[model samples]
Target: MREWHADYLDACNRHDLDAIRSFLSPSVRRAHLPSGSDAWIDDLAELFTAFPDWRWRRVQLIAEEDRLAVHLRAGGTHAAAFRGIAPTRRHVNVAEFAMYRVMDRRIAEYSGTGDHIELLAQLHGGLPT
Candidate 1:
């Protein structure tokens, strides 16, 4: 699981959509991505566009049977619009948490959350007064 997940992260870091897709099941269930793997991939593409240098590093990982949990730290520079916020050219680092269920050596299901509030705050010059 560790090696597989590391390779998955490497694909993401490389922005290789095809490589990332190879790690997912055909019917993958992504809790945060309602439209399925395609949507999730599209979202990742959008993020890469917004943060051209985006990168994620695993901070923690736990594996049990067919399940795996991960904590990641993501950092990047804001180079384009994101969630309607114009580019601020700010650098942001945020935490992300995810849990995955692997089936047949591929990710069958997963759910995750990120520190979006902190990201927005950083992009917006430390939130509203």
Candidate 2:
């Protein structure tokens, strides 16, 4: 399961929704950030649609009983439209973190965070202050 976390990242990097979906349990529930802003991830296709070039790199994962905490640097060039914004063609890197709870060899829950302020700044062609 520890390696599967890495596999997920690789699949995400490739923007392969099918591969990413292969990792989900039927009961899979993923959260973008822990504050409960979103109820659930309906499908993997939408996940990749939102993050066209999402790549998780410099990953440090800790695997423990029933859970895995993954720390990563997520980045990509914005080549595709997202969130109603035109493509920025911008290379944005952000320090992102996530924790996954796996049950029965499939991810059951996930929570995550990142420097949104910095990402926005980069997207606007401004360096983070």
Candidate 3:
């Protein structure tokens, strides 16, 4: 599982959407996003467009049976608008955490949170009111 996850992260780091899609089940459910992998892929595409150099580094990973959890540090330069905020060309790094349920060696379901408040603050130069 560790090796598999490493490969998955590598694919993500490369921004290889097709490779990333190969790691997800057709019916994969991303609890925070829409119901399927297509929506998840679209979301990633938007992020890539907004931050062409976006990257994620794994801070921690834990696996037990069919479950896996990870802590990640995500960083990117604001080269394009995001979530109604215009580009400020600032770089931001934020923490993200996620847990996955794997079935048939593909991610079946997952839920996670990213430090969006911190990201917004970094982009806006301070916490928003």
Best by lDDT: 1
What are the per-residue Cα lDDT tens digits for candidate 1 across 1-129?
999899999999999999998888878887756646787787788889999999999999999999999999998999999989999888888888999999988888988884267778878888431
What's model 1's TM-score?
A: 0.90
Candidate 2 per-residue lDDT, tens place, 13-44, comes to 78775676666665665554332212233333
Say which prediction, candidate 1 or candidate 3, comes out ahead on lDDT.
1
Please rank every candidate by TM-score, starting with the best.
3, 1, 2
Q: How well does candidate 2 score on lDDT at residue 86?
A: 72
Model 2 CA deviation exceeding 4 Å by range:
32-53, 114-118, 125-129
Instruction: Give the CA lDDT, 0 to 100, for residue 26 in model 1.
Output: 74
| Local distance difference test, candidate 1 | 0.86
TM-score of 2: 0.73
Query: Candidate 3, clashing residue pairs?
Result: none
